[model samples]
Target: MQLRLQQRLQERRQQSLYRQRLTLSSPQGAEVQIGTERLLCFCSNDYLGLANHPQVITSLQENAARYGVGSGASHLVVGHSGPHQELEEALAEFTGRPRALLFSSGYMANIGIMAALLKRGDAVFEDRLNHASLLDGGLLSGARLQRFRHNDTDHLKQLLQQRADVEGKLVATDGVFSMDGDSAPLGELATVCAEQGALLVVDDAHGFGVLGANGAGSLEQAGLSAREVPVLMGTLGKALGTGGAFVAGDEDLIEGLIQFARSYIYTTAIPPALVAATLVSLELLTTEAWRRPHLQQLIARFRAGAEQLGLPLMDSQSPIQPLLVGDADAALRLSEKLRSDGVLVSAIRPPTVHAGTARLRITLSAAHNEDQVDRLLDALQRHA
Candidate 1:
């Protein structure tokens, strides 16, 4: 067994598919430190740059003094702290939902939502390019899972029509695709789901705290109400620069998740300090509206620069920009070149994406200034 495992690991390395982690000694920001080297970081999900904000850090510190570092138990037990409730309420109001429930992570929230809502005879239609968590949730639901082409509502509609015999139908998609950085055809998908009487689930982990005028996320951007999209999931660790995740919906859905979602029922609640820090970050997400526009500008600058340089850029309007390198080894080489140039961009390889579609996943953050973007462009030009 050990020999087989070793062979499989070696195969991954030979295919350039082995993954590694970097130890960050500094807080998450546009510039991060690894040991003594400060690299221009363009691979973080901190779109709005609230992760290292002074106010967010202060809130965490103060709340830790008040509530301690760990949540003592699960939310159903006694771990549902004041800050947890407060953050839930804030998120509900922000998303214009009747209620919201928190989870330890986006994966748990996605899994819990599917498990709570789906049954053995039900059907789940998902986008082919949906996040791994959403895909896993569909599989775990004991439902007949059908995957449609990326952002193709017609394909989803056809799948829904074919699955008409199922007891229940749920359609799930990522509001903003993480790797591709393109948005789902949310309005069209909602229309199809409505026509088919299928409940729509949207994971806006990459969109929340970044899109919309009020930073309410992709639903707001698409003019979708709670009625249009039933289950809305968002993570606090991305643009909010905090930790944990939440699902917002009408009262009944929240109540059902509370009752039937085993992932939520069995897991320890997220820390009060983290939740408190998220509250601060949430506040900043809404009130400080300039962050979104600044981020858009940065994305535009990067895209335009990449275009001029004739980089193999994907069609993405969001902060995530992929430079398609096709081969895993080539993508790794490009990433290493940028790293050697004091820039941090990760190479995303299969099976995170399809084979032969390996690319450099360069992410932008509002914490980054125009000059930093220029520096990234310069490095890409030199290395790519």
Candidate 2:
């Protein structure tokens, strides 16, 4: 086992597909400290820039003092605290759902939802470029997992028609593609699901707290409701600038998950302090309407600048703007060059993305200013 693992590691290095973690010595923000170097970062998902907000920190601290740090047990046990309940209620209200159930992470929430709702004879259809967690969930659910073309409603319709006899049908998609930053054709998917009697599940991890008039996520931005897209999952670690995830839906769904979702039943609940901080973050996410527009401005500025530099930019209106470099080695080289130029951008490679589509996944944040966006553009210009 050791020799085989070592060989695979060496092969990954040779192929320039090896992954490494960078040590950060400071809080998440537009600028990050890596060791002694302070870099202008463009790879964080803190879109609304509340991760390090003073009020959020204070909430965490105060909650910790009151409720302690760990949840101590699973939600079904003696673990779920006041902060957890409050956050779930707030999230349900924010998403306009009947109820919401919390999970340790988005991955867990996806896994639990699929496993609880699906079985050996059921069918799970997903977008080709859906997140790894969603794919894993389908596989684990013992269902017939079929992946349609990415964001192609026609392909999804054909698949649904082919599987028309299947009694339990669930269509799942990422509200926004994480790597490409493109939104799913949600309205079309919802319509198809409604017509076909299939349940539509949308994992809006990247869209929540970043899209919609009140930061209610992709469903809201696309004018979808709980009736249109029944199962809605979102993460607090991204735009809300906190940790954990939740699935919001009608009361029946939440009750069913509580009874059947193994991930939720087995694992310790998320930290109450974190949940407390997230509640504050949610308030800010909706009230501070300026953050979204400013983020859009930055995205536009970066896209325009990248276009002028002849960089390969993908079609993304979200904060995630990836510049496709095509080759893993080239992407890594460009990322290194940017690091050398005092900018921090990460190289995303297979199998996170498809082969030959390796790129620099540049994420913008509301914490960034016009000057910071220009700095990234300048670095890209120099490297391009």
Q: For each candidate, what TM-score against the reference?
A: 0.99, 0.99
Q: Candidate 1 — which pairs collide?
A: none
For model 1, residues 274-340, the per-residue Cα lDDT tens digits are 9999999988876788999999999999999999999999999999998999999999999999999
Query: What is the TM-score (0 to 1) of candidate 1?
Result: 0.99
Model 2 CA lDDT for position 128: 98
Q: Where does model 2 exceed 4 Å of error?
A: none
Clashes of each: 0, 0
Task: State the C-alpha lDDT per candidate.
Answer: 0.94, 0.94
- Model 1 global lDDT (CA atoms, 0 to 1): 0.94
